[model samples]
Target: MQLEIISRLPSTKSTKPPILCIHGAYNRAWCWDKYFLPYFAQAGYPAYALSLRGHGNSAGANRLYWASLADYVHDVAQVSQNLAQPPILIGHSMGGMIVQKYWEAHHSHPAAILMASVPPCGLWSPSIYLACQDPELLWQLNLIQFFGLRFVTPSLLKKALFSEPTTAEIIQNYLAQLQPESQRVILDMLWLDLPTLHSQPTSPLLVLGAANDKVFPQFLVNWTAKIYDTQAHIFPNMAHTMMLEPAWQKVADYILSWLQERKL
Candidate 1:
């Protein structure tokens, strides 16, 4: 699978791997930073954003049928494996799942960052369970979805995706980047035990969460960090899209500090 990679480099290259960002499912690479690319580049680290197989700037139109959870691992693999030093591998939502799965199966460790990620094996989620109780209801649900696409939720639900930067413009911008698919196969992809994955990490891992995000929620984020025996922090006035929020610089600063403290 071809990855669509865009780079914004710092004025100089050092012997370290630049920060590499991975966007969540149904989103393109540019979803990373309205301010992130230039800010990090200016801060002296080469910055990169990847469009996994069918999303964003990458080439498949199967936006409906052509990608998998592992395909995203391949995307991250391509970008981070070649770093001068291991690049800080950051992922959001489904992208977070990808990073976790990759680390579980491979030797790459670029100090992962996961944001608003879904719990693996949530195909049995209560919401999914309830939706499947009635045969006719299930059929209705399937129609609204493409591959695995869910029906658009109300704004109240959207509010949960972010706490800060809830402006109409920001919402519209994200909506424009949304991709839909009826591909449920990816949802069944089993992830390794989080505790086990965390145990094997060779570098410091940061689990950044939005104080107000409900999609992945604070408790889950904290749980993920705690299991890893590392650190977790909340972004004040931030959302699931921490990398794009008004206080994105604050998140980046945290990332820099985490790396500095651990020397990753």
Candidate 2:
């Protein structure tokens, strides 16, 4: 149960609620450390990102295949509970669904941000969409679940994650860090662990998506927002991994502005 939580604190203390970022499938907490943690910390919010039990430097990699969505939710609950104050939860992709599950279970966070998150209905729609729209990419992604990084290539990675062509170094670096996601968690997200609308929280919510995200298309993002009675802001020319994109600052700035508007 020793999850890895990476944190960055601002030089000047502020009253803003700490921000906790959750990464998507095939990703770890380090995904946030490169840009988000520092950006938010510099903005005076204590930013933290935690690797789920089997990801990053966290323990339980040996048991990754059996890790369930509930287990991932437990990890998030543990970290957020240990924070000084209730955190503003920001989750991307699968992590976003995790945030939804967390809120449905605890309903204690100050606010929640869902970026390129899966819709409450589940990943079935996207799976179908990808199956038709880009079968190779979908096939590669499935192969990755069992084969890990060996099945990934710069071209496929770019197609799956980025709208614009990324540098070779960046692609290699990400490839090196990418890990196989849990099949059990994937199955849960595909259907088993969907959030309950009846238990939805009343706290503020923000839904964001990339205009060019192939994984969770803009329509799904809109659907996710609509389900929560909110609107989604889709960034043009961005892909699934918005935080690591070239214009990542735009996404960061947008989130910062939203947080400021709420006076969080």
Candidate 3:
């Protein structure tokens, strides 16, 4: 199982900050394309997005059997340790959770941003089902994963996760990028040991939430940050797919600003 890293560094010495973007469960590294990688690169921060083992072009590892979450964390660890400077670690959904685990294991100066993704508390609680604001969503979840002929349909996952704040084309594009089993494995990790991961200390954390998101509830994002004594910013116009939100560039701005503030 070879790791496929979309490593992008700045061309000029002046653009020296490095950022590592990690995507969520059931998703490939391309999820960051709508925002993180390119935006951060333009912000004078070089960025890298890696397709975890069993994900995207990185699949083919037997080690990815849902137990690979730790391996995913180590992926970040390896990059973080080897980088000349501690990179700004930004994760969406499962990627955010992995960043947390990495910080817990390393305790370094790397900053982190969680955008409409996972928080200190991983999704799966009854509250999230309620926050989904869709009464029949839970029922549909099981049906899609098992019964539906189009089990891996991006349209369905997009509908379950996004609240119409993202465009159909964007959803379709992202769906095309997914490597299914990798997505399943990471979600399973969130369900099992999320609380322990949440207990770990984090650096200047930014919890970005989409008020309209159907998957990760706004309350969970807010609460997760506060519980860890960090700050959060909510976007009423965004959906669960914060990276694909119409004004996804706004997310990039906020993150770059946060990184700047930390430097100040």
Which numbered prediction scores highest in TM-score against the true structure?
2
lDDT of 2 by residue, 134-205 (tens): 998899988888777788888888889986755677777778888888999989998888887885568999
RMSD in angstroms, all models?
4.4, 1.0, 2.9
Give the candidate order by descending TM-score: 2, 3, 1
Off by over 4 Å in 2: none
Residue 14's lDDT within candidate 3 is 49
Per-model TM against the reference: 0.81, 0.97, 0.86
Question: Over the stretch 19-81, how does candidate 3's per-residue lDDT look in tens digits?
Answer: 888877656777776566777776677788887777777855565545456778877777676
State the lDDT at 229 in candidate 1.
Answer: 76
Worst 10 residues of 1 by lDDT: 188-197
**Pairwise TM-score winner, candidates 1 and 2:** 2
The TM-score obtained by model 1 is 0.81
Highest lDDT scorer: 2
